[model samples]
Target: MNKKQKKMLIRILISAALLIGFNFLPFGGPLRFILYLIPYLVIGYDILIKAFKGIKNRQPFDESLLMAVATIGAIAIAIYSEVADHENGDYVEAIAVMLFYQIGEWFQSYAVGKSRRNISDLMDIRPDYANIEIGGKLEQIDPDEVEIGSVIIVQPGEKVPIDGIVIEGESTLNTSALTGESLPRDAQEGDEIISGCINMTGVLKIRTTKEFGESTVSKILDLVENASSRKSKSEDFITKFARVYTPAVVYSAIALAVLPPIVRMFVMGIPAEWGIWIYRALTFLVISCPCALVISIPLSFFAGIGGASNAGVLVKGSNYLETLSQTKCVVFDKTGTLTQGVFEVNEVHHNEMDRDDLLEYAALAESASSHPISKSLQRAYGKQIDRSRVTDIQEISGNGVMAKVDGIDVAAGNSKLMDRLGVKWIDCHRAGTIIHMAVDGRYAGHIVISDIEKPHAKEAIQLLKKAGVEKTVMLTGDSGKAAEHVAADLGIDEVHAELLPADKVSQVEALMKRNTGKGKLAFVGDGINDAPVLSRADIGIAMGAMGSDAAIEAADIVLMDDDPIKISKAIRISRKCLRIVYENIWFAIGIKLICLVLGAVGIANMWLAIFADVGVMIIAVLNAIRALFVKNL
Candidate 1:
């Protein structure tokens, strides 16, 4: 407990003891009234001061004002009855209301503390110091002070401290804090590693590639810390509702106290018992306090964001979380989003020469090119290319390569290149990129290569369907056959193939229009070219692990591990959070409405009004805390 809570607890204990002891005394008249007043002020002095401050600040329509008005009116009635009616008034109920209000307030404070601690525990990856070798010895300095390209030493069990490339040594790194993956990743020389990963075994010498401010860990920490400032539509509506609702209830309470009494005495010619009516008005005020609605609504969103962060899903704000919960259509880019984006040889069909000889010629002819297909051919050849064996090499844009390998005319390219050489090449009905090869004006066969799908790609699509996503679509720049093959394998509902970036934007817009009555559309992509389409969608989700910087910046949410399955988990978290929010809203408002009506009709008293206010608040707050447990998702 905080110091204020501790002090409030002490005051509640002392006031409760005094209220109990004074009930046994036989004192009467002003002496007993004075004795009860002491305990009343002890329990409610801070409330009175806050009420006065609110009025002085010209903003008095909050819960503090309602509580002060009700308790003070009750006290006035008790003291007046003791002096005028010659009967000792009930003062214990008034003090007990204040005591319980403080109790509810303490619980809310502790609950908020716990919610913040959950987020902080997951974000405990910021390193305190970076060990850099200034001379022959290592010196520990602040991570922010280290410059890019500086060498840093990471000992066993220490964080990587910055985003860098490993130049020496090898180790196993625990990346759970960053990726939410439980397994440790192996690191070796020439490998790139990000910050926030723990060096588990061996020492590593790293060359820093990014400044501290631009590192992955810094960006993630900044994102989580500022998430709460961006309020969702639900939170905004509650704020506006409270602003108008509080003042309206205050005026209604005043009318209940004065207007009915005046109507009874003048129009109906009946005795207006002001004390009885005033007591009922005070109960109405207590019942109408909007504490439960105001506190629980924002807390639910806060805990949801924290829980998602723990799962390696970074939601930029509550507004995005709200949008994610309503996603019925999810559009994904083919390469780097669903597929592995790495090309490899799928097969070598109908090779006239040996497979290795055909691949060696293709690899030699395409050795100078940097395209992905060329790299894939070289990787498949699995041998060093003898550059001296090739001569008169020429690359045709949009076609393929033509070269003389060991004084033999070698043509390795598409069917267009074979047609240009007057060689008839057989078409292979394979669902991949085919490289047609010709030797000395003779057709030699074709080699097929393709990008492999991710391990969880099929499972992610199925899980999304199970989680209530209605439609799944894929957009790609590959050929129609290749896209259709992948879409069929993954059970995608729709496929748009051979599309440029602008074409993708148009397709996404068309998809958005088709789903007009449904929930929002979300686009997931991982390339610089996809940034425009990502930003144009209702929600942009990026693959953070190997995604481009532009795509990450344009996206509203990022999957840290580049795992397609995290998308469904994020949606599940949002739905659970929104469900809890609506539950609290209906529960609090329904109870308050019923209690308000009863208080106005004199059916409810001050003790029941206290329960209607503080007791309901505690329950709603506990329900809001349920948004924090999403590990099973």
Candidate 2:
């Protein structure tokens, strides 16, 4: 317990003891009243102060006001009963009400504190300082002060301070804080590492590529910290309900206290029994405090976001979490989203020249381009590219590259490039990407390059089906043949292929129109070209690791490990959180309405009122905290 909770517990204990001891004494009139007032003041002084402040500030419809008015009126009725009928005043009920309310408040405080600690522990990835070599000695400096391209030393067990590539040394990285996976990843020279990973085994030198504020750790921390600001629809409903419900119940309690008493004397020709009716009204007010629905709804969403972060999924806000739970159609970008995105030269076709010579010419002509197909050709050549051997490199946007290799013209691209060169090319009947090559204005050969599917890509689609998703679709810029081959292998329900960036956005818009009221549609992608489609969907899911920064920036949810399986896990977490939210809303409202009716008819007393108010709040809070346990979901 925190210090404030500890103090409240002490006050509750003291007040309960005083009330019990004073009850046993044979006290009768004002002496009994004065003694009971001691416990009341001890337990409820803060509540009374809050109530008074609420009235002073023109906000008198809160729970504190309800509690203050009910207990104070109960005391006044007891005093009047003693003065008029010589009956012993009963002051224990009033003090007991305040005592139980404080106990409930303490429980709520502790629960919120526990939830905050869980989220804090999961996001403990901020680096304190960076080690920079200065004057033949290493000095610790702020990460923000280090400029781009500066080499910084990282010792064993230190956090990577900025996003950069490893320039020297080898080490094992504990990425659990970032990815929620316990296994360490190996890092060597030329490997790109993001900030917030801990170096576990070796000393390394890193060249900073970004400032601290633009690093991954800073973006994640900023996202999580601001999540609560965007409230879900359910949370907004509770806020509106409480504003109207609290004042309406307070006015009804007033009518319950006054109208029936006047009618008994004037209409029914009977004694007005004002004391009994007023006591019932006090019980009514306590039962209608609205504490449970007001507090627990928001807490449920907060816990859900915390649990998602622990599973390596980052939800930007509670509003997105609500939308994600309603997803019925999932659209995916094929390249990096479902496939390995690593291209390999599968076969050489129609080669009239030596295989080695063909590959060397293809690699040299495309050496200046950093495209994946170029890289695959360079990898297949198995030799360092000498850029000096190539000259006059001209790149065609939709076709390919044209360059001079050893003073001979070499063109490597699709059939369109060969046609533009006025050379007859043979079309390969391969399902993979085919690149045709030309030498000295004649068709030489073609090569086949294919992307490997991810290990869990098929399983991820199946899981989405099992999780109640109605349809699964894949959108890609690859050829129709290549796209259909992957879609069939992965069991995707629909496929759209050979689309540009603008075409992807139009596809998503058409899909959204088809899903008018059925359910929301989510688009998942990992490339910079996917940002437009990601933002235009119902919910945008981006791959955090190896995904372009533009895609992550425009996405609503981020999967840290870039694993396809996490997509289903994220959906499950959202569904579970929303389930808890609806459960608390109905449970709290149902119990309070039932108890309010019973109190109106005089069948419920102040003890039952305590249960109606404080007991229900404690139960709702416990239920909200369950959203934090999502490992098995």
Candidate 3:
């Protein structure tokens, strides 16, 4: 418990002891009233001050004001009964109301603090400093001071301070903090290591590629810190409901006190029973406090976001989480999202020259491009590339590259590129990507590269169907044969192939129109070209690790580990959270309404009103905390 909570606890115990001990004394009249006033003031001074401040600030429509008015009115009636009828006044009910209200407030504070700590511990990936070797000695400095291309030494058990490529040494990295997976990943020379991973086994020398502010840890922290600022539709409705509900209940309570006694005295010619009506009005006011709906609704979303972060799913806001629960159509980008995106040369066909010679020519001609197909050819050649061997490289956007290798004109691309160059090329009957190659005025074979599917890709599609997703579509820039093969293997409902970046956006728009009112459509992508479509979809899910910076920037939810299975897990988490939110909403409001009607007709009393206010808040808050336990879901 915090200092404030401990002090409140002490005050509650002291006030309860006083209220109990005074009941045994033989006091009467003014002495008894004075005795009870001590405990009442002890338990309720802060509430009275808050009510006074609200009135002074011209904003007196909150729970504190309702509490202050109800309790103080009950005390006034007690004094009236003691003076006018020679009876002892009862003050226990007023003190009990304040005491129990404070207890409920304390429970709420503790629950929020616990949720914040859980989220804080899960996202505690910010590195304190970076180590740089200068003059044969290591010096630790702020991570913000590290610059691009500067070499930093990450020792065992220390965080990698910036995103960079490993230059020397080898180590096992504990990536659980970033990915929420317990498996340690291996990093060696030439491996790309992002920030916020701990070196577990050996030392590593890394050359920084990005600034500290642009690192993964900084972006994640920024996302989490700003999450609560975006409210859900349910939260917005509760805010508007509270604004109108509080004042309406205050006016109704006033009518319950004054209007009925006036009707009985003037119209029915009976004695005016003002005390009974006034007591019922106080009970009605107590029952009308909206603490449960106001506090628990936002807390549920906060807990849900925290739980998702622990599971490697980073939702940007409660609004996105809410929309994710209603997603019925899921559109996927095939290359990096559903597949491993690691291309390998599966076969070389129709070679007019030696296989290694054709591969070397193709690698040399396309060495300047960083596309996956280019990298696959370079890997196939398995030799260090010399830039001097290639000259006059020209890249065509949709075709391929034409360059001079070894003083000979070399062309390496698809069949479209060979057609553009007026060189008749033979097509391969393959389900993978085909790269056609041509030597100076001669046809020189082709290289077939294929991408492997992710281990959980098929299982992820099945889980989405189990989670009630109606349609699953795959959109890719690959050929129809390659795209359809993967789609059929993974049981995807639809496939669109040979699309550009703009075409992907148009496809998503057409799909969105097809599912106009059925449910929302989500687009998942990882490359820079997918950024436009990610922004155009109803919800954009980005692959954080190994994904382009532009795509992550445009996405709403980021899967930290770049796993397709996390998509289904994220959707399930959203549904569970929304379910809990609605449950608390209906439960709290239903109980309050039932008690309010009973209080108005004199069937309920102060104790029942206390249950309607504080008891309901405690139950709703406990229910909201259930959103944090998503591991089993």
Each model's lDDT comes to 0.88, 0.90, 0.91
Tens-digit per-residue lDDT, 265-349, candidate 1: 9999999888888999999988888999999999999999888888888888999999999999999998878988889999997
Error of 2 at 325 (Å): 0.7
Worst 10 residues of 1 by lDDT: 543-552
Pairs of residues clashing in candidate 3:
none
lDDT, candidate 3, 348-426, per-residue tens: 9855599889999999998999998899999999999999999999998767899999899999987778989999998
Each prediction's RMSD over C-alphas, in Å, is: 3.8, 2.3, 2.0
In terms of lDDT, model 2 sits at: 0.90
Tens digits of lDDT, candidate 2, 576-607: 99999999988988998899999999999999
Better of 1 and 3 by TM-score: 3
The model with the greatest TM-score is: 3
Greater lDDT among 1 and 3 belongs to 3
RMSD of 2: 2.3
Off by over 4 Å in 3: 132-140, 149-151, 406-409, 440-443, 544-548
* Worst-scoring 10-residue span by lDDT in model 2: 543-552
Of the two candidates 1 and 2, the one with more favorable lDDT, higher being better, is 2
**Distance from true position, residue 454, model 1, in Å?**
1.6
Ranking by TM-score: 3, 2, 1
